[model samples]
Target chain A: MTDTEKVIEIQVLRYRPEQETEPVLQSFKVPFTDDMSVLQGLQYIKDYLDGTVSFRWSCRMAICGSCGMMIDGKPKLSCKTFLREYYPAGLRIEALAHMPIERDLIVDAGDFITKLESIKPYIIPKEPRTLEQGEYLQTPQQRDMYEQFSSCINCMLCYAACPQYGLDKTFTGPGVLALMHRYNADSRDGASAERMDLGYAHEGFWGCTAVGYCSVVCPKGVDPANAINQNKMNSAINYFTRFVTPKGGTK
Target chain B: MSKRRPYVRSMDGWWKRDAYFVKYMAREVTAVFVAAYAVVLLVGLVRLAQGQAAYEGWLAALKSPLSLVFHLVLLATFVYHTWSWFNIMPKTMPIMFVGGKRVQPGMITGAGLAAAVVACLAVLLIVRGVAS
Candidate 1:
């Protein structure tokens, strides 16, 4: 709103189902403060320049995991990415890669939600615990077994960074795989046998070629590639054991 | 009906656009060298089965300048494969705790590399002893 306010051009991909056949880049000049984030920059454009330019965002602090977008062609949380860093060079904002773009800067996340649900994200108790038995207890060491994988917020940036998922949607993908590992690694959980069926499948961990971009792009440090690759080893061992195990012992 | 036509992007050749992906592709390409080395060894074994004269001819071909160049290239790729393999090995394994603290990935990679060097040296010593 001031004469000296620094202005930067943000080239955002716009897609309107009623109008355009495909997404196209639409440029907007946004005046931003040094502390302003990319999400704030988009908000400024929506409030002042164009009300129609739509994007998803919630907690502005990267925790909500709703503000993921491709900033300069890399998957990133728009809320966590500062506008000042990309200043002078500006930035190109687009929907997360691989997934279908539902609208401007918004990818259809229905597939991800479905995959997340399929993993059985909740802990299936090893032993039925009654109210009198009290809440299930866990040692610090037990918590550490799955703590790293538990940090995934379902942002799907790992999915965006994954070429395997982009090539084949049938692949279980990274974020969901990490969530699967989280429950499996938990000591109190007895669903490992059930989850191993999915993990050992051809469409599961075998789909990942270990391109490793997933871990690098993950904002939560969830390292879904680690989870997926470790499961690949488990799958490999299980694969060899299936032939040797007693007839009815194998799944 | 809902007005929704979600646009899907192509993944084919997408790695060509990024340096990170290019490096990853290069690492993957190293597998060709491993396969080639295996094939060459298999040919040597076949030549040995054919008799001493055939084995000598096979060894002579390996000593040629072109084959030496291939060997050099294979060596470089082998080095890269070893380094990258150890770098990722820590991630693919469960966390190792020593003294109740998780071992660092860098430390794990360093240990793996050290083990590889010691094994190579032991192999070299055994080969030298056999030649003597």
Candidate 2:
């Protein structure tokens, strides 16, 4: 590397069970061009100074649903975040906030994945049919209702930003709730009755205190807060209507 | 048992270290404070319903050291509840637009707090007028 190339200082949070009780900042001077990302700098360190430094990444292009970390206290995809943005002072990288740290720059995301499954993440039609029938038709407006939520790559920056999720582990959180909203809004899905039962509980929509950090940190503009809050209205209506409406009233 | 295993653990105390988890804990803790203030108001109402002599006795009790300590704690909780309520209010309600531009969250919270202060002052004035 030439002297003309800018040298950026990267400070990463490190934790090892045998050596450290909690994460600590370890800084490294990395030589970089304008095109280098924070992920590349960490890779450089791992390849050179410390082979044991741990993190997660797969699709360097941001599609593989990995390489999420807290860059300067904000949850972001490390592969997409460039060092040029924090030019002079370098960068500080850590694992996603509000999740258990398994090791250096990696958090255990089992809770989020479980909540996703609880909502029956797959489509369940009202009646069984074969492929011989035509595909379930949906209008453009119906597609528009859920188009924004469909963009979620499950990077989980929203989970890190959510204080409510951090406080109540059982609370079905922002990302998972957005996914639920996606399926619920689908015209082909016939599981609203079954899904509403899970979404209406205290541990579901009602648990959200609406800190709104989830919406702010969402990389895909999923707006999971909107999904959770809008569903709260649905849940409340469903609760009140249970007494008035008979079972299987409308198709 | 089936071969399928749930990917996430279903257990307690999982959220202790998460930052978002800590935020939710703070919100729940503030809720206790809100409930405590409600009880204080309910006690006052009961005293008033018992007539002048009973209300005067309740007022005297409120001036005692233990009662004063309780009031201090209540005051702290009420402040927390008020701040948290205002912070989350914008999320629940529809956005307020003026001249085709939306009002800022901080502005909305400030206006709400000002209205609360005015309402409290109006209640004090009415109470003093009725007593005299």
Candidate 3:
């Protein structure tokens, strides 16, 4: 494409902690094609125009779960966001919402990782399995139960759309909750009790205000809001059952 | 002296302090508002059933400035509750698949709100006819 056809103006929020205290909007006119993604546009600017621009990307396709950024005030995967969607007019891009920007497009993900760990996101068998037993048997119906939640790529787009996640950094947001549901719904997993302690806490299941934006922003159709709300019901049942059952009951 | 590993009480001071917890907390808070509204309406109905004078007294109480302001607040919360409830209805219910296509959330919420409005109008018409 020629310069006139290739040129696409993109406004980016720039922040460098080492040099600058706050973020500022910087515009760049770059050569772009209809086939290219927003990530490619940024790459072009980095390779040709300016090296100071910072962002993250991996897998270039939508699978790696990196390259999540705010495009026109919405959390989206830059690699998946097509330039054709915002052609003729320039576009505005920024770091994901609700998180402190480390530099240009990179936001702190430590809180997200910590929340994931808090949920005990691993399978625990109901009974100890012997190696001779081979893999635990599961029917198609059982696999279908939690298959949707297993699609979560940990993209964190849901976290950006979630105002609750913005207000409270430690609240274990949607991404982690979806992961927790993945394990909890597993037929082989018996760690529901161990995980419920975290899910039932004041800030755990109860903290979700159910804005429903998390499900809207999820790229992989992993309805995190549903997972969290279902857990809320589970937490309520567990709360009442503890008094009625002896030996702490069974899952 | 024994060395103590610094342990953060994850549950302590969680409300409003943690974003992840706040979303669920907000939902619970809204539930309380819904329950309060239900109880208030139920009490009004009970008074109406007792006698005309008792029903009139309930109406008078509602007309009071404090009660009016409280009702206004309740109305706002009720609207919020209704909207949020409809938004989440799709998640709990089985997906409506027609012609091998899943129904959208917007369609569900729109239909629910429309039904609620129609139901409210029907109630108002019935009450007006009964009063006459």
Candidate 4:
């Protein structure tokens, strides 16, 4: 409790089942150093200011992808965002945008999880490999096809930043679509025909209007916009080539 | 335990909240001018078929100050429309590989813009040669 210490104001949107009808912002002034992250500021509020404030965070580093929130109306990883950036102006933190707030600073990610699973994030082999067979090897060029899209940590920030998803929750969304492209583009994966069914569907990659904020807000630089848009071209070609090619162009 | 009610916020006027959305909307709006210019050309083609008197009247209409201002606005929107279309084309198109190296996004935009400039110049030269 020193008078000389520098403090920053953090406004968190709080939701309680019994107390509030809807989420509302509550302001708190907390002392912060240059190194204090937005996640740490939320921690200070929970630790001292209010015990009820809830958020999800793991791996204090940015790898966990859990501490995502709408910081000043932008989707960001709170753990990676420092409080010093908004020292004088202060920050209004809310649960991730375009989602139902389950509680204070925590949104319902059930929809996101379902979308992730629907895409089948794992790789399906073209053919089963016998124990005697060697590992599936790919050239450097082959890896480059799907390399940049493989970095999604599923933080759901892309979902929050996506206006299409915000307007219509049915859109397959950026992160999951990027992950879908990651698996589909893999040299050894032979499930492109299957994934393209979902990719070309009305609610799939076609859902994106290409606002492109998904790439800008992404902490991992996964470029989900690029992945989804590339598939738009692929899907269109697949439609035209279904007659000419027996397997179609999804492969 | 009591029931839980999750508050889903309304997303009204969502595009107005971000500058990116404004830019995207602006890009989309250029299509209006594109359609307008197409209409102008269509009317011109119809006037040409109607006979010389009607074609001369259309030519006179094009020489009006109001039409000049309209054409100027059309030029600006067409430029922006072309730049934005090619600017986003790389993302919309499949990844390109040349000489075992991936083509850079900037290169794609640059190539597209260069091609557009070349095409415009060729059209200008051909129009001049035809007029001469």
Candidate 5:
């Protein structure tokens, strides 16, 4: 429409379960500004060209973590990836890697939801207190122990980036492990023993071969690699000391 | 009974697909060389325990051109293994709280590498002093 405005071709991987057995790429030329994100480009295609092109997004600022997809074969938040950076290149967009495509750019996240729930992401208090009793207090040091891991927004980007999770869905993945560490590291939480089966299992920390790409692709800096590897030490210790220590003494 | 059929994509040649995965594969492969060198050293120790003739025979075998090239490749992979091992040392250990602050990861890796270098040098110096 304009002489100076720039447009780039975005090849989206389309899948409709009822219509297509396999996913195929559909290209759309989108007019873009330098500041436009990949998510914005998909929005343009959905709004102008194809209303049936489905994807997920909420907060455009990368906080809601619903807009992750495979941008040029890497798991990334479409809201954070700028289209200008990949301009003039053959930009391929697909549903997140290692996930089943529901339709278009949306992938089924039920497995991830199940894994997240199994980790028990909330803090189980060390002791019970009466209603009239004062709230549990924490020092800055206590909060610092698990503060970085608490930043995960359940984006599932790390799971897409994890090769172990791709190869075997049974392995409890980086996001869940990081949240497990988050609660375990909390000074007031005492449920680590309950979660030890997952932490020390063959499908737990040992499943990770320390590929460490999960940390690289993490949008929230949760560093699930760090979480998984740190738990390797816990698992190793538990492996040797379990014979001596009584049950419910993993801490 | 269920409508869900999750298409599981095969990840064959996944290492070849991306540079990140290629580097990861390379790092993982270093373990092979490390194990090979361990076996070589173990054989040498066994030869030494056998007798002087057996020890000299093993030394002669080690001096062959093929063995030299193999050792060179082993050295490269061992160095890579050391570098990668040191890099991930911080991740494997519990978080260090020094003076009410978390220690930086770079510091942990740097300290580990420095300690390794010092230990290697100390061993070399001791071995040379013993020979002299």
Candidate 6:
């Protein structure tokens, strides 16, 4: 609003179910500081320009993983990505690729949520330890197995980046599979054999063609590609050794 | 049924949209050249079993300039295949832990490529030994 203040163009993909049949790019010019994020630009648009602009955000610090969108054809957290990076030029924002757009910059995350729950993102101890049995202890060495994979924030940015998921929604894409790997790699968890059944399915680890773009777009450094591909080897081994080892081989 | 219509974006030519995807497609297409090389070797093997005259004909074909060009193309594709195969080895394989620390992905790729070079050299030496 000042003379010295600079303005930037933000092109947002708008999709209102009642008003518009399909998503359309709507442009807005907003004044912003260097430290302002792309999320803040959207906030400015909502506050002054257009109130109908709908998007999800909470914590606004990348932990909630809600404000994920395609910023210039790349899946990134709008909260973490600064507006200065794409300033002066036209900054195009769209709902995450390969997902059904619910509204402006909001994709339907129902599929991702369902897949997350289906993977059972918690440990199922072999023998249920009661309160009397103290805690399930894990050494630093054992923790190293699943440490890298455990950092996933359930942001579906990796899903947005994955082509296989775009081609086939049935495939248990990157984030959920990585979370499944997290629980499976736990030393105290005995349900890896159970989880391996899901991993062994056609829509599981085998579905991944190792494009590896999932890891590149990850904000949490989750390396979902490594998780999925590693399980592919595990699935291959289980398929080969199933006859010899009883109970479908060890996890 | 609910009356909610969500717009799903068309992913047509999505691979062409990103350079990373184009690289992946290129890597996948290398398999065709690898299969071609296999077929060439198979043809040579079949000719050897047919007769001495047929075997000599195959060898003469290999000496042609066109065949040399084809071989050069094959070599180029094979080199790319070898590099990409090792580059992705760390991701496809299980994570390596050394002395309670995780092994670096670069180290894994470098080691795989080195092993592949050694194996290729061994195969060449064995083929030379068989010839002389």
Best by DockQ: 1
Model 4 alpha-carbon drift over 4 Å, by segment = A1-4, A248-251
Backbone clashes for every candidate come to 0, 7, 14, 0, 0, 0
In model 2 chain A, which range of ten residues has the least summed lDDT? A242-251
CAPRI grade of model 2? incorrect
Task: Report, to 2 decimal places, the DockQ of model 1.
Answer: 0.72
lDDT string, candidate 1, A1-251, tens digits: 89978999999999998899988999989988999999999999999889999999999888889999999999999999999999898999999999999998889999999888887889898987898989788989888889989998889999889888998999989999988999999988988878877888867788998888899999988888889988887787777787787742237
Clashing pairs in 5: none
lDDT of 2: 0.78
Candidate 5 lDDT (Cα, whole model)?
0.88
Runs of candidate 1 exceeding 4 Å displacement: A1-4, A243-250
Candidate 5 wrongly placed segments (more than 4 Å): A246-251, B1-5
Which runs of model 3 end up more than 4 angstroms from their true locations? A1-4, A249-251, B1-84, B92-132
Clashes by residue pair, model 2: A98-B18, A98-B19, A162-B20, A163-B20, A166-B20, A166-B21, A167-B21
- Per-residue alpha-carbon lDDT of candidate 2 for residues B1-132, written as tens digits (9 for 90 to 100): 442221221236644644665665676687786787688678888999999988888789889999899879877776766776666665554334576555666787887787777887899999999999
lDDT of 3: 0.80
Q: Better model by lDDT, 2 or 4? A: 4
Q: Which candidate would rank higher by lDDT, 2 or 5?
A: 5
Rate residue A250 of model 3 by lDDT: 44
The C-alpha lDDT values of all candidates are 0.89, 0.78, 0.80, 0.90, 0.88, 0.91
The DockQ values of the predictions, listed in order, are 0.72, 0.09, 0.13, 0.70, 0.61, 0.71
The C-alpha TM-scores of every prediction are 0.95, 0.69, 0.76, 0.95, 0.95, 0.95
The pairs that clash in candidate 6 are none
C-alpha positional error of residue A205 in candidate 2 after TM-score superposition, expressed in Å: 3.2
Chain B TM-score against the true chain B, each candidate: 0.94, 0.68, 0.73, 0.94, 0.89, 0.91
